[model samples]
Target: MNGEDAIRAVDSLFASVKNADIRQKLGKPHTNAGEILPAGVDSLINSIGDIDDQDIFLDVGCGLGNVLVQFALQTLVSKCYGIEVREEVLIHGLQLMDETPSLRDYCGKVAIVCAEASTIQLAFERPYLTSKRQGLSQ
Candidate 1:
């Protein structure tokens, strides 16, 4: 999709999600919300080098799922997770993946949750331990 088309797609996706009731039910709006620019996303992903199928990428507080979507489309990572406190936003992200043909490749690869980041217990499937322990000299 071109710039206009992408914008239109995003706009339509947002239009389709009616978060009014969800927001009202919450009683207060989320304060931790924002999206990384496409350029920044690109740079960040590119710097990550290669992504294996077993590797899972996690984005905390992923608003609108922009970063997750970008990562799924731009990289070969088969699994991606986004922890979002808002349900409607995650729904909107899923809706976007369904609507955009370019994102078809990532259908079952993306997962978004409506929960706090700190509440998540699993850090990584396999803990990546460093030789030198923090605050302890070897």
Candidate 2:
């Protein structure tokens, strides 16, 4: 799908998850909780430029993991990580992935973690580790 189409699809998938009942349960305005719309995701991706399959995308304070889902759907990134401090929000994000059939393909690429972004330890290999290994071999 084209970029616009993809954004629309993402928006549609998020609509149910972002409904009033969910918002009321969360006890805050979606905007105040840092929920980003699909358009924002599109803009963010555009600003970040190209994403190769080797690249890993991380979204700090990822409200509902919609950004991670969008990146996984639109880019070739090998992995997408979303860090959310709120357990409730993270639960909803997981629900969105589990209940949406269309999101199944991209769900494998996305991971939503419930923890403070600053406290979480990502176990993925760092670029420096690869470079250091290369230097030692050379």
Candidate 3:
């Protein structure tokens, strides 16, 4: 999809969640994962080792594309996909992507979808990044 379409897809997903209001009233941060990931999360993501261009990385419960964006920035993975159920979070990430001049270039490389974590598809049946794969750890 084009840049605007990518942006709108995220926006529409957020619109759906805002209309639902399930997580909004909980006082949780709308789109960021700062609450769940401890400090140095970005550093940890950057430190991941040995990912290649043919690998398709999936960010499960990817919130606002922070981790996914980081992944794309740090590595040369063939594709990076994120599945987040909340439209607000996905839209929020899209907004961030649109705002960041450098990240905006990655719109074509990264894909975000609004869907349940359990229902999301993965490129592999198992984790692509794990201790077993060394630098591929996620």
Candidate 4:
């Protein structure tokens, strides 16, 4: 989608989500300061380092799921775990994925939760020492 189309899609998605607090947080215009990385938000995805083809990546405070989408498209993060506190933003991200075919495929490999970042835990399916050695080899 083009810029205008993307904007309209986001606007429409925002309209469908009903949480007041979430709406307030997302409805306002956003700045590209700390919300996005210095090298561009996609760079953050690249910084996650190597994992096996099946390892899951966790994105804390994933606002509109842009970083998650970028990683899903361009990297081998395998699965993405996005923690978003705002219900409206989460809904918008989900709806956007539902409406876009490529995004839908990306979403298939992702799990999103609406929750506080501090409370989210990262549990390893395998032991960290083994995973770290494997990640290094990759």
Prediction RMSDs, each to the true structure:
5.6, 4.9, 8.7, 6.9
| lDDT over C-alpha atoms for residue 114 of model 2 | 79
User: Who is ahead in TM-score, 1 or 4?
Assistant: 1
Tally clashes: model 4: 0
On TM-score, the stronger of 2 and 4 is 2
TM-score of 3: 0.59
Using Cα atoms with residue i matched to residue i, what is each candidate's TM-score against the true structure? 0.67, 0.76, 0.59, 0.61
* Candidate with better lDDT, 1 vs 4: 1
**Number of backbone collisions per candidate:** 0, 0, 4, 0
Candidate 1 residues 115-136, lDDT tens each? Answer: 9888988656434444232454
Q: How many pairs of residues collide in model 1?
A: 0
> What do the candidate models score in CA lDDT, each in turn?
0.64, 0.75, 0.59, 0.59
Give residue 27's error in model 1 in angstroms. Answer: 6.9
- Which residues of candidate 3, in runs, are more than 4 Å off? 1-24, 27-39, 121-138
What C-alpha lDDT, on a 0 to 100 scale, does residue 125 get in candidate 2? 57
TM-score of 4: 0.61
TM match of model 1 to true structure: 0.67
Q: Give a tens-digit lDDT track for model 2, residues 25-105.
A: 555544435467788888888887777787888888777788888898888888998887768877877887888897788
